[model samples]
Target chain A: MSRLSIRSFSSSPIASKVGYSTVQPVHHLIPIKKQTLGKRFPELNIPKDDIRSPQYKPKDVYQDRVNEYYQNVLKSDLLLHYYEHDSEAVTGNKARSWGEFSPYAVYRRDRKPKGLSRATRDIKPVTPRNIPELTGISINLYNKAALEESWINISARLQLAQITNVKPKVVYNKSNVLPWKVRQGKECGCKVELEGRDMTRFLSTLVELVLPRIRTFKGIKDSSGDKSGNITFGLSPEEIKFFPEIENFQELFPNLFGFHLTFKTNAGTDERARTLLTSLGLPFYKEVKNVQ
Target chain B: MWKSGLRKYSAAASSTASAGNSTSISSTLLLTRNPVITADVSKFEAQYYKYQNELWKRLMWTFPSWFYYRKGTISEQAFRELNPGPVFNNPNIEFPRGRPVVVHQRDRRFKQELKLPKTYKEVSQEKKEGGETAAEEEGAKEDNLSRQIVPNSRITKADESKDLASLERQLSRTLYLIIQENSKWTLPTFKEEQVAQGDDTKDSSVTPLHTLAEQGLYKIGGNSINYFNVSNTPCHVHKSESTREYFIKSHILSGRFVPQSESIKFLWLTKEELGEYLEKDYYKEIEHLLSDI
Candidate 1:
């Protein structure tokens, strides 16, 4: 907010060169709203995470067992497991840049990376510093029935909040489809992004209490993941009932909602992310394809 | 990085270097029993957590009783009976300290406390009802989910008696398996059988470091140990003039490590405890590999 001092950039050579008129470019990378840029609003100036700020919330309320296990045990084990002697970082195929001083190449985007349409992340050898750890978990509940009855999404949101202990944000439809009777901006679902203690708590509950109770759960499919360290798997409404929060209160939650859980990690690849998750007690099974 | 330096002196290269005087290659099992319970925190940490937990509870929203316990239901009546409503703020009464700001049956200033009706009657309650036989019958139904959850004590019988050989001794620490051979306590190290030199047909007999460790473990421990090998690769290597010991990292998942031979005495101990038993210089070389927890 007002903590950042405003400086005149008109005098600088770079600013002068890019200047179209008398007005100078803003020096700040992030544009501050005019209403929040004054000393009168002292509360706005304080960071949201600071104790003095109104938005401050205590996170580490107790010793997180799941996170502690990862730190003390899984970390070193993973580092040693992934260790490779004389292994070098395998750089990803990056987008090719046009030759310098080419008139046609000016203001043009670079060509797509080799083989892959998009650039993939470089595979670095695992070390003590860069050992993969669960960063966050994003649970998204898509209520297709809400497309017709918007109020139905309320139950989904409430269901998510009850299980996660965090209020979910309502997700809206982006496009209209006449065939499906879907309209743009319709409240179709809800999502909650969990981190820190809440994330670990959810992870422990899922692994220890819920997953084992599920009858048909072989394991998470080996193929599930975004290839970029985020592994996503969906729980059926029947499977979701295994959660202790909903199990004892089946009468209260008459209509249960299923959700997709995406485990976000800094492992950089799906394979490593899967390994990290497996080490944390969530099992994975190889998906067998039927041969005709 | 040290692994790379040791890679040059691998068993394959070293065996070929000095055909006559080949250095003995051995596999050292770095078997560990991971902490079953959360690590014990310091006084400062415990206090900080308690303070934060209290703050969190104070800031928490009132539990939605209406949602869980619908009005007019038998369960709702039981819940109401268990958790009586807080003191109401009457405008007619004069306030001395402060008027209680009651909202949703909770005082806004204080942390809300609620109790649900117990699924099973307590043993003392049953005794008051003159049902001595019922209390004895309830003791047999320990696995009943309706019974109140009582967590097991963190300190096991092994800990109380200071039995280092038991896996349950230290529930909150990483325990390593060390054996006593020739009256010297050290990590379980197994040496490869020296094959005859210049035997071209028996080249395939050379076992991988991890395989050697597994074979050695079953040989001494009677194959009862159900362990998970972290990887095929060796985690660490200890170099000596006469022998090269490759550390094969593994975790004992279940089962007991029974000593097949009476001469070999083994103990599962924590990092600090191992330092006392192991040779000072030998422990110092591999201290970084052990987990502090």
Candidate 2:
């Protein structure tokens, strides 16, 4: 509740004429409340990780059929167990006390092959149904000038549609902010979501014709993931000309604007997303070393 | 046959004598019995004879007397008045001198009845009644087909999984050629002319293979000669909603791209860029061919 200071409205001449009954206090509810364990028993509240079994295996098992025979037959441990000390060696080898058993046997056993983690070992093969694919690409334009002048919003919408080859939806200001000059429900920006063939086509233009041609464009930084398989980047106002649609009718748009491009993918993890994206032909700057 | 014919001649003479004295009912009966005199006498004779030759035949077959004997042509207005009505009058109901005062409502059901069949019983009786063997056979055929389909589906699944595994290995070092159309970047594909089957091989220029080679060179440009060795068959195949596309792989024997078309630009994007740029299915088709190399 606000401090019960002198009511500013009561002092006004209009308030005296209208009477106190005309003015009513508006009730505002708080958005969030602190959590307490409600009426449930404390012991019954189990964590999700606790419920999951320790052993992990994907439903779609990726068994190496081609190397199945070799895998079953040839295990490095079976062929040779290089122990560190004399006591650690096998009975026959230890009795012989031969130095050539393994000159490099400094440790108990050599490490497994590079990508042989438990997670990778138990991976399920990807099917056509579960294949990681591009969902859609969204172009978002935040027209800061629109807040000051309303007419700019209309031109921004037209600009986005012309460049993206689809009609854009007008984004409105959600809240009233006097300082920023934004009014509630006023059109402030425009966005377009491209899917299916259009998404692919737009992506093709950005990756090939537009992004690479930009002088300052040095591939997407490794840190640019949304942590949810979606990668987003921005282009400058000048880069808009690289789009063939925009390039063809350069006279139409005298004042070009830049926009944010978001690539949505079905890969569950950022790593899978990165892999899926890498295959599509986008370059990642920092991940180059890691990928190699 | 001769005796009966003579008896009939004597009877006709007596019937003439009787008709001369007083017109008798016997003569009227004879008129009805004679095939030429009555309209349905031939139909009655057919019931007994049942054979073509046995049935009495008219010596001269002509149109009805009313047609030629009428005052005008058959369809003329006056001809309708001249045409004869039924020979016997109905004793039960007398024809009114003028239009009858009583008006009866015409039954609409009669017209509707004409559209329906007279009897529906015979139709169902004619339907062939067979055994369940056909149904059993059909079920067995379906079972066989389903059985055949099961293994095919499994084989395809296995093949896809195997393909995925091999794709991962191949992805590390694949070189992609992206061709630009309008503003969009897509995989570089040579559009081959769809040739009709079994055409003459004399014109090597028109063959699909040759056409692909020519277009491939044009799209690839003359600059890739140093490092790239373009292959004969495509490593990845994609089909858009409109056209069939294939992604061909070549070893990067050594050089960079030299743009060929003014509007149709070209770019050498990494696998990740290709994945992001191309259509989902298009990228997926060549996804296996991509790797970190």
Candidate 3:
């Protein structure tokens, strides 16, 4: 290997000055092609000048952005069309996201529970037959808290993505607290989105299988506030698949899947958020009962 | 019709080819510079239909459709194109009217700035004089033939299959059609690659990581699996497919996974009740099924 130069992140690290406080402008992503990709993937034979060029023109970036937005929105809708019948996110048959995966499900790690307890589960994780996850591992989510008792669920929803062999998406909705308005500014809205295709092969085993085992649990109330209950979340595109309800969707619809975790809160304050989640019979974190 | 990015990408590509000492393929077939003006759906659908139909006929009749049988791969591709995502286009999406503001962060791209790394595949003066001995050429004639596996990395169910001919041919045809419709066509260019003889790659055969890196299959995530060696056995952070690969490789490199004994194997759960199942070395013997349908 004398001729080949190898660099390791552990040894020589190029630290990112940007913190993960808010979203980072994806600035520019140079596809870090595999070394042999020189021999293997001729498709990436992008012109050096193009790649080496400082940055795309503003108009070019703008055009690309417009195309990407429409596609992302439609893609999310098509994926989440199934939740329409069950969720209240639809208006005149339209779906949306508020902040769906974070509060009760994610920080709590209850998206995919590893074990099944007759005493604890209402909808035990089935054989994972219909909705094949990319991860070979599957968790049974029959209750709202299958994996652990902690709140502020920030688990890798992808842990179960690879096991079931379905396309995986990393969901990051913070909470599922619903809002006061029916169509507009509802903080309780839950969100959904598609993560990525690159993680298909080398996806982490925990993400592909184990973590979901920790997250699976029960869901929201059947009659907390809805005539035909629906919630919204302000979700980015990556967090949609973590929701268990996507599979029940059969047909393709627009804006169906992209959303975030928002929940219907009877109380706007932290204590009220707990009381609200409690009333819904859904799980919620106790420490940050003050967080919206 | 459908403008092509191939040439535009190629023209910009040519500038980088100057970085190395190799015969330039930029002057080859990739010679169109037409900006892929994504037109209104009408023209897009027209050209897309033609390309899709032609591609469908060629691929379906001659090639295996099993990999892309989602109803004429080109058609699906066209459909997606005619309907590209909005996030790529919508710069202000984060600021939807009356919405909470989320911050945008930037990651310092891995700034290795490749401190003048030496080339692995250096051409011998004699080889260069012998002049471009067609790279195992004629191999392309077997249009239906799958790309030969390089045999460098271990093959698994998840890893991609190597089908060079199919990829080149498909790309070429699509590119050609794109060029025919575009007013400008420029071939894509890239920095000349560094290739070294096997002689240069042998200094560190003692370690599996070193060996794989020499093979060039080693990357940020490449690992050796089911091979016997020392460099192959480093513990990974997680146990997914990628992790298992590293684990297996590290073990093999360390002589833990014996190729002769069939000691290590991957199990696809035949059932979803794995949550209840006890952990056993079923790494080789268990088959799990999807817990949900």
**Each candidate: what lDDT?**
0.81, 0.46, 0.26
Tell how far residue B92 is off in model 1, in angstroms.
Answer: 3.7
lDDT digits (tens) for residues B123-226 of candidate 1: 44756587568566577567676655557899999999999899898899999999997999989998877667765234476567778889999999987899
DockQ of predicted candidate 2: 0.00
User: What DockQ values do the models have?
Assistant: 0.26, 0.00, 0.01
Residue-level error in angstroms, candidate 1, position A160: 0.4
Candidate 3 off by > 4 Å: A1-155, A158-292, B1-293
lDDT of 2 by residue, A7-29 (tens): 22122232123111213221111
Cα RMSD (angstroms) for every candidate in the order listed: 10.4, 43.2, 31.8
Inter-residue clash pairs, candidate 1 = B174-B293
Candidate 3, residues A173-292, lDDT tens digits: the string is 243433511222212221122222222221233233322443433333332322212232232223434433333222221122232233332221233233323422334332323576
TM-score of each: 0.87, 0.31, 0.16
Top-scoring candidate (lDDT) = 1
CAPRI class of candidate 3: incorrect
**Model 3 chain B: worst 10 consecutive residues (lDDT sum):** B172-181
Interface RMSD of each: 17.6, 50.9, 27.8
Backbone N/Cα/C clashes per model: 1, 29, 179
Best-to-worst order by lDDT is 1, 2, 3
